[model samples]
Target: MSEAGPRLGGRRHSDERSSPQRSLGQRKPARTITIDGEHAGRRLDKFLRSQFKGVPAGLLFRLLRQGKLRVNGRKAQQNHRLQEGDVIDVPELHVDTAAAPRPAVPSTLLDQLRGAVLHEDDDLLIIDKPAGAAVHRGTDVSAGVIEALQHLRPELPELELSHRLDRGTSGVLALAKTPSMLRYLHGLLRDRKHEIERHYLAVVAGRWPADMDIVDAPLRREEDGVVVAGDGQSAETRVSVKRRIGNRATVVDVRLVTGRKHQIRVHLSHAGHPIAGDDRYGGRAFNRRVTGLGGPGIYLHAAKLVIPKPDGADLVVTAPMPRRWKALLNSDL
Candidate 1:
């Protein structure tokens, strides 16, 4: 994606947090927006997701089915490719007041984010995302890193997430500044033809086996959040023991072979060494102990990533372990 689009001024529509200050129960009027070069060629559903970060895909699809969303004055499929100059017809919408959108991101947090930037080019912006922050807004979160970036740089075109880090996990997060760059990254991540190394640092309960080198299992997320081990998509992780904390815990390096939701947590828990602070995956006791010891939020950090750049050179990005983590692990991080 070449940087060939007009940079729009004013608050970006992409940031739900920057939406006009309206009462939660208020209903917004219908709108007609003309597509521009920056957003052209994107699928309607994906584009909508980028705009309405808090809205669910199901509800967005329902809006299309109800004829509340249209392209060029006619209903169109979600996969429809938008072109420059095309008009988007949008109907009245009830903003999810439940999210409690913030009118602005606190200047302190924005400044922290600016300082966290790892790399930035014309096509991409990479940052070391904090562990507690989400990649995108959701039902419980008013805004995520993307929304804050949108608020921070309203002159830039709609920013798209090339990859996501779980709210509980922190590391290098990348955002594509253009639609074409976003599409390219999406294809690269999904196809897996190219090897992208995503390495994580985790502290887990008990000593990890020296003989056990890898965890190759199937995973499925259940309603209760306990990912089933043997009955889902194939997921694999390469684990190497980094150090042992006086026989109380083990710090390990985890590399993802197949990225699946909760794969590391599931694999570790299944192997009887759940992450020290991951209460969701059968580590409640360990988590409580970790809290007593002042461990990190989840005893997990997306520590590093190696990705291929547009020029075919490998870009290696890494996030340092928290100071607290270093102190707790006795300099093992």
Candidate 2:
């Protein structure tokens, strides 16, 4: 919906409008899209789906196979990741032209996000991402934090996610307002430089030992859909007990020394103190218990980030602990 693209090389009458509710199976005029910073690294299918909302995935793949989708004037595949300045050609297909009919983002959430802005300059935007929201659309999520921001700020066409936080995790989500900033930040993260450090707050099951802080484990993804330690890529995390909540749980601060897939969740689980409400790592019983106490999903937050800038001053951003976590922390349980 929302007029997926600005018509290129086409003359339109002042009063004519394409049907608002056209079926995806019907034919329409072809259109071209020039990739920009926001869409640079997105997959072909995912990008197309975002543009032509309501189109089925299977049909999208079929269109790709039929050469209905082209990149830079050549046929492309669904998995093709778009690059900056690349041109995409989309064939005619029945598509909705109205704004997406999805539910509007809650005003409370929007207000929270608006108030959560930690830092913003010409190059970057940092927000305290709320829990239970994806950074971008994926699997079952149709619109995510970034999409919501795009809707709220239509003028920021170059806004791009610098890094990602899990859908269930909260706090300190960084976005790039320019491609160069995105690349620079990514480089710092990739090189594991001390210029940028990420810290998280996690509530875990059991009373964590005060001195048992480091978890160095190599992680590997197995064919069975599990990430196991001792036989994979190198990974490390620095853990410290922040608060002990009786014997039921402990609030801990985690420093991701080497980021990997589900690194914090898997390492903490392997260390025998899985983060509460982490369904994939923490058992279902633990999740039920935590939720039973009115805590939301996984109690992990990207609480703080420290970045060194060219002028020598550090850009430090911190997000307040969620109220539920605070309640749990101060509770007897």
- lDDT by residue (1-333, candidate 1, tens digit) is 223322344322221112354454656655566776667888999888766655667877899988778888898899999897777776667766666455556566677688888888777788888878878777887678888898887666567788888787877888888777788777777766786788999888889998898998888878887575566898889999998987778989999988788889889999999987786885677677777776648878888888887789998888888666866687322
| Candidate 2 off by > 4 Å | 1-112, 223-226
Runs with alpha carbons beyond 4 Å of true place in candidate 1: 1-5, 8-41, 48-75, 83-108, 331-333
TM-scores for all candidates?
Answer: 0.77, 0.70
lDDT by residue (1-333, candidate 2, tens digit) is 133444321311111124344445545756656775545776788667655655666777888898877888888988898887787776667544353365355565566676778898877789999899888876687678887787676556556798889889999999876555676787878876554888999999998889998998889986654476567999989999988888889999999988787999999999999999898889777778788775768999999998876567789999999877766676666
Clashing pairs in 2: none
Q: What is the C-alpha RMSD of each candidate to the true structure, in Å?
A: 5.9, 6.8
Candidate 1: lDDT over CA atoms? Answer: 0.77
Scored by CA lDDT, what does every candidate get?
Answer: 0.77, 0.77
For model 1, name the residue pairs that clash: none
